[model samples]
Target: MDDDSATGVAMTRNGSTGERQLEGDYLTNAQGEDVVAGIRMTKDLSELKKEMPDLYAEFERIALLLEKHYREMQDMEFTIEKGKLWMLQTRDGKRTAQAAVRIAVEMADEGLIDRQTAVRRVKPEHVDFFLHPQFDPAALAGGKLLARGLNVSPGGAVGQVAFDANMAEAWAKNEGKAVIMVRPETKPDDVHGMLAAEGILTSRGGRTSHAALVARQFGKPAVVGASAITIDLTNREMTIGERTIHEGEWISIDGTAGVVYEGQLATMVPDIKDPWLIKLLDWADSFRTLGVWANADYPRDARRAVEYGAQGIGLCRSEHMFFETDRLPYFQKMIMADYPVERREALAALLPFQREDFAGLFRVMDGRPVIIRLIDPPLHEFLPDLVELVAELADLKIQLKHAPDMAAIDALLSDIRQKEQLRKRALSLREANPMLGLRGVRLGIYIPELTSMQVRAIFEAACMVVKEGIDVHPEVMIPLTSHVNELIRQRTVLEGEARTVMAEQGVTIGYKFGTMIELPRAALTADRIAEHAEFFSFGTNDLTQTTFGISRDDAEAGFLIEYMEGGILPANPFATLDRDGVGQLIDMAVRKGRASKPDLECGICGEHGGDPQSIALCHQLGLTYVSCSPFRVPIARLAAAHAALQETGRPHDE
Candidate 1:
């Protein structure tokens, strides 16, 4: 064969046309000249088709035949050897989420596959990626790359960098600027900043870190564990190599790609108005046996969940309701109160706000089961940082020492006294390990009033919404119940407050009381706990932490990433379910709980609920549902269908 005559051909079927199309064809040497630097210039596909029409036709025929055999789009590579067309390789073509959707729909339309098979072909992540904004290919190519990190959440974000949570909140809220929260690692206290920011970036932490979890919950773009980036909190800047990104500097991040770039990059939001996605999800709903629910706290989230086809609100975290600017002060007052009367007064002030919050969610959910987990975090989380309070007090003392007048001295002394008291209180409440300390059921039991207050608020809200002609199914879940007695105690408080509210409103409302199976002991003794509880929502976030004896936030930001990368661990157990350890616990709990009450309703309301692998396990274990963030409802819906289809080996209709 002549060197110039040898040609390579690549072909694929156009999704819209189903016609064999030559993607590219190139000759080894167009001029038949000696190669310079062992490189060969090539002729284009048009030239190849013009010169060798029969050869091109033969390749096209072969491509179509391969595609037909595979029953999918075939990417074929071929070459001419000794004037004869030779096939090199052929396989299913890889495609983008956009292409995947278009191909699936077109293939179904072409009668190559049924609608159910089309739904099964596309993965949940593909659907999720289809919904998020992505960096424009042209703009992304032109942009200067800064660093790369774990793609904790899927989306694109453009904003000015903010070093801390307060700066992020101030910049976003006060100046109306879109801020990217740049933190070493985020704590629960930094949630306000995370909520305000357009996206979150952290120098440390893996995909299941606090930053990752909250970003997913809020549906914000996030890149965590960017080890290349060094955050200097004191200087309000992050350094990547020799490049320093100061606070208020423009930066864009591709959370899906996990790439950080300097300055703004244009992004294109996917046309979520695609009819194919709607059709695919409809098919998913038909096949799925496991219920898909949303971990929604606010009415807005609930509404979005409904729009995305969430069957119900699986986890309504009541603590998130108190984090708003208008409500935090009252909650803090309640936390800092020295006496029960003072605490009750503060709780009384917060009751109306709580009621309104729950009522709004209930009204949006429209009678779907809303499993509301009562206040779970430790009290110290609500208070001002002890370090910040101490610093302020030290500054105030310095001012008091140099007071120029009696009036000034008196005012300084008053401020000093208040700061001192707060510092003391914060110190007293601070725990060596807050996660294992006074949180969840312990906090509620320590101050039964807190549980009573939240339960009353829930009942009052349900009653209010019920009277407004809205159906309400409130499932009050007690968090972190290691002992059956704790559930027994909290259930009594829940029922009493519920009865009192129903009597006051002159209307009875139906509600279920339940406990979150977060601790090993709780899982071990699930039968006893189930005896008192009407439902069990597995809080796998803490359950994983407790089972592994690792703090999720600390571990993910530290050794957990190493564990995953070093091959000591298969995956981040926080992100995917630890099927052996945590899964065993869950399976045992479900079996034991069902043994006690055969009709016991069980589900998971953790970060894992949104994970496809975990959702599959939950399906295998016969859990009732999986509750993820509002944004993840569609993903869960599709994943649940996949789980069901995998089990049954056919669509629901078949």
Candidate 2:
């Protein structure tokens, strides 16, 4: 053992099977806890070597012997007092993803391990870490690190502070500043803020918590369960020991490292220039049996997915496209239109936009299959918030009452009345339970033109792509489908639109139509529905919601955490698959759906798709594919490979 270095000098590999390094630290005139607890500034093992060369040489010799004896790396701890060296402890060293890959590959090449053994050494989570950006080494070395926490998501983030979700969103959206949302813990209501923020820092909650789960899903940099920091929401500041960080203070965070820095720090994007990871993924693909796809909506997402090795587009939620700034007007106009002609005209205005959107996606995906789900949410989602509209109308009425000019007063009154009408319409559209209300296939059935316009755009885009000699497999997916008739009705409408577009473009292209088996009834009666549907995509998000009768949006914020802490639920069913209840439904659907139509293709396009555990379950259940967000494509690929290896009785390190 050597003094002034790592507490325990170990020659052992990390959880990731990373390469071992002579890693240790030393603080002058301090106890071992000072160095171990990181309470004092510390120097690396090299500093000790510089101070005592003879002792350092002897320590290195013993370390090598320890590794040889164990046939692996070792972690060691020792002390040197009065020019005498002492070996206190020795074990394997922990390392980063890069070190893990480099070490394993080098070990295999060095005859320390076989190729299969090396492959088995790397964890799936480590593979995921390779895909995220890191803080620049030089910048991080110079930066002031405030605290450490569990890294729920992997990436580097730099932004000003925001105390709560509302502040986070307001700062990001209104001030146009990237913000790190600081919270005691997060709730479902914080999603908007989470989306707007560049990173999230919470004082409580572990990896499987709501905050962490959503952060991963959003692909944000997140550090959770940070106990060192105390959040003072009343003052909009966070206190770490004696240091207080106020709102809007510039800060940087490394989710991969789980370090919160005092100010902005430079970041290095993943080393895509290095072909090592690319080669590794290719190797993974060779061994993996499950198909990994992406839940992408736009061309950008599709392109990202393709770059990350997504096999195809498993879910293209077209409704998300409507939320884009330029396209929202057409969507809102269609929603507010009183007559079918007006709505159709609004949809007509949107047709070219949708066609172009689909065309771009096809171009990016090339010949890969793209499953596009038609509009699924209720129309109210396209309108202004009912409460906000009413408040605006009330303020307008007050202004009208105070107006000095008669003409101005009359105009104000007219405007107020118009606002009131829109507000009333929005209210009328609102349901006590919107998720279980008029959404998905029901929306398509009730509002024929909505589905018609989307189908028309899809078919027309396909025809255009086919005329250009690019093979495009466009699948129209009807969401929230619970019955055979819903599938048949939407299929008929989609087929009619397909015919119309084909005839109009003077081109023919084959397409598939499917329904999302979200409702329990749909899964239970999958055989009957499969007869009318060409494919099935399990919408596990809503499936979990309906199965447990839990409102995903509101549950976590309310009693979900309590239930979790109380051990009422093993995990957040929304975050992870509830295999017994929700999984049973999934199993039954896959079995029955395939029994009815042996050629039926099935996959899951939900939040669960990106979860490694859920991916394993899907693999075990024989699902064709699992689709997740574009950023999760790499994670899913690695997870799928891990699952395949585990099933085949190969080394499953993860």
Candidate 3:
């Protein structure tokens, strides 16, 4: 394969030839002041070299287990060098553009790595995630997790937990407290609370919901669809079935895992400097310089600004394009319209609005790999109920006068009535439990036009940008894919349409189609998904929620908090990772995906990207990259450096 400038020639499948070559390069780079910048390198230590069931040793077991758990590229520091592999250190690694600076420059200071090696480590894309507002572990501990929900945004908060938007604003009104607004879901009215609250929460909504969009717009922590707790807006209180709680109660919410607790719980912010992180990235930098990309749905996610540096965006969701009001209306228009033309027209109305949104994003990224996930939600989400529509028709005929206006209303009403009937039938056909139901690819299967409009808009944006000479690598990803057949089907529709539009406009472009490995089925059947997918981005958020059978929306209000507080659940699986459970799938998926397709690009786009421990794990796993919001990039980069440097402290390998 050709190099993308940042990547270098790597070792082959066999370790002996590549290992010897890498050793020579390692010596030269180590000696010169500018070795990294100039020397082309490669190191391939395959599974065959690392695997030997009979060569049993403590470190070997540890290394094997670490590899088994992570299922990706691994850099482990072991006590033994030749005879055995001792577990001295382990971390998934990738360098931030800044950390590349620090490692190459600082290593020179320490007489370890020289200046040229530093520039080689730094890449154009890697530096971007570092430039956002990141939390110092001290800052994370500075505040508290009053109540936990999906931490859509990374970092910490010190604020009064207000139940409603109004309370959030009122509390934030007086002074020092950075208000953390709690809500069952956010509305346009909640915009103020979103403005006032340090973070936001919702009873229902996906990564592409109103609450997520508004919070991301404001750069606030958002935990959406946390339906575990019922909010009593009338009583100014909330209920999690048996437990009743009122407003003004101070609690910490872990937006990462949707875990809400009674009071401030102790926090352990994983350090970007953990020795494990440094050792890992150093190993990655030693190989191909392929710019690592992150999948981001929001601008504030700071994909470019995470602690563990990500090169740029691999996927960015565009339909996460509106606030509460716009979402329902846009959805309603798509669902309630009498004809495909009507719905397509409604989507057309949203086009200019979407283009403008992408324009701002283009500005944020400047020029990088921003793979926009086209609209992938079900149409029913936007439509009002048939029962409600029927009721409206009855009210109009029974209450209004008999005139031309009424006649026109009657005609339109008849069409609406037919559409309502079909919609009702569709609902009945839907699965009893819709989370694993008629969503994702199914929506595209029936409503192929929905995917069509989104693909066109994305391409139009690309064309708009391309005409300006801006290089944009747009990636289209299919969500909720439990089956490989589903991804292939969805891609056929999306790619087919995108190609058509490209041809008509006389614009040439290239994009990758991939699936988000967020389900057990997706992971278990990864080899199949890889056959159709150009790359893979592990959607650990949904993956975790589905894996635990926890309502990401409601888990916090019920018993997850209790479980964490009582030490039943070590940490919210949403916040940290449940390595044994969900991680096992990620490990399986990577190994299977690679086994089927060597050189398959893989990465993580969940909240774990900024997490120091998770980042280290990604380093050890041999993942292509770990992506978080832009703000968290700097921290990710530093964490990557730590994983690399940790190798130094390992009881010298020899």
Candidate 4:
């Protein structure tokens, strides 16, 4: 039989000379001794029962026997040669996430495996991938391949090309078009566009780049560092070899595969509420000892996390709350203000927005703890790029020389001068290393009103929610505390402002004050720092950066990949907890802090929290919870359960 031939049945009969021969006259001229007549072929396995009843019965019996012997599903291969069936091979088959879930559930139901074995078979990444949208296989097969890059985030997206952040935002919000934001790289300033676009594509940067980090946080599809593609921002186009794609042209990207396609492709969104997935997660919850929380900054995220069975909110970066179009201007004004009163006015303007946001989150996560981190990033992040401002100022000066009249000349000069002043101020604030400079607790301490304002908002929101008969557990976290005095100073401000808010609202609500142990100093001296802290939330993203003496944003796009490939590093420290270096700090901090304050609640709120290996490490360290993005809550829950099962060597009775 030909190896490529379809599965079929061939008929034969015994001849007078004791040889197998064709039973019909149609095979009279056939050369083979076992020439067959009325051969039937089928691509379906079920069709075999009708075409070859005996063979199908034998195949089913063999399959069942193999499965029983192996104690798992068996993928068998068989061949038919000269009308005789021959078994070829049998092994465990690889499966997609959907198949994995269904098989696990069905096998447990069939008594082939217990529920614990079923849960153990399904990996956490399988659950995460099963919940997202995927490209239709047929459509993707026909798509024209443009380039491939790092699969920084998972999902399928198809949209028109957008070159600039402003244009991407406008095309998405105003024209109501799905957009893929294509850039050489993204920065903190492009967050609005990243939010507005359907997906993100960058020609430069790796997994931990700004583009990748933000894309994962927002649960958007992203392909980064496609070096084969060249982005020409000046012409608003991108080129891959001979192919040039202009703005508004259709394109499709599979972030899971890191492939860029020339045109749109069909997509299928999986049902996250699939019955089997729900049952598995419920079993996971029963087994997990460590709590799984979400790092949700908005009410919508909090609601989604709750639906995914998150216990609480672990880290809410208050700085992210200021990135909205309506809020960014006020935040920028607060950053650029020259005097105390002006800054206070800007902060006051922002207070109502913060309060309303917190109130919404509190209402959604009514009985869950919400840890709101004070404004963490450096002030320079909120300001316009100094280089862009200087370039604009120079362009205005050139236009000034070609003015049509005195009125135009005066207007151009005034604009030029104002831009020049703004450029000077931006340049003045620039630091050689802004990440290590004025950020987190340093910023809060340098300008006491910043933390003071945020604490007031948190307390005010909690008080308002409490009066509405909602139980709220608000945690005020002071970010980047390297010394006991820093925590002490911030705690004093927090308590004072919290007290003021409760008195004003005429309501009392329970709350906790904590500090993020993100620096080596903080971890080493955690005993002293814990004196003022009721809890400790490890900011491993920064801790890894600080401990490694490398900037995560820069290293990931640069030597980090080389390090991992060369075996200099076991894994990306930013993605997985460095068990020897960074992990030691976390262990030390937890032990030291708990020693000082016996009830010190410790948890991790970092990118690693969503990672399976990192979640296991957090469990091993005896942390209270692991907090990750809202979309990753289910993955974290499952991983936490796996950790518990492995440690305890048994499953919880359902």
Find the candidate with the highest lDDT and give its number.
Answer: 1
lDDT of 1 by residue, 319-437 (tens): 98889999998988888899989999999999999989989999998869999999999888888899999899989988988999999999999988888887888899999988888
lDDT of the structure predicted as candidate 1:
0.85
The sequence of per-residue lDDT tens digits that candidate 4 reaches over residues 382-427 is 8789889978988898898899999999999889877776677778
| Superposition error at 275 for model 3 (Å) | 23
Ranking by TM-score: 2, 1, 4, 3
Q: Which residues of candidate 3, in runs, are more than 4 Å off?
A: 1-310, 322-330, 363-367, 378-380, 383-432, 647-654
Put down candidate 3 lDDT per residue, 1-654, tens digits, no spaces. 111111112111112211111111211112222223664342222222334334333433554455446532234432223434334355643333334444444444444444334433444234332232333435345654333445565433435567777777777876656666766666556676677776665666666455765565445656767767787778877676576667766555555445455554444443445342345344444433223455566656533343345567856766567434655566556665668789888777777667666655555565566666655554444555657766775665554445468677677677656655656754654455667766666777777877777778778877777788777677777777888888888888788888887898789877778878888999999998999988888888889999999976566434665575457887667766678898889999999999999988888887777666676677667788877765556556555544554543332211
lDDT of each: 0.85, 0.83, 0.60, 0.83
Query: What is the overall TM-score of model 4 with all chains considered together?
Result: 0.78
- Which model, 1 or 4, shows the larger lDDT? 1
Each candidate structure's TM-score, on Cα atoms with residue i matched to residue i, is 0.79, 0.83, 0.55, 0.78
User: Which is the better candidate, 2 or 3, if ranked by TM-score?
Assistant: 2
CA RMSD for every model?
A: 6.4, 4.9, 18.4, 8.8
Per-residue error (Å), model 4, residue 517: 0.8
Number of the candidate with higher lDDT, 1 or 3: 1
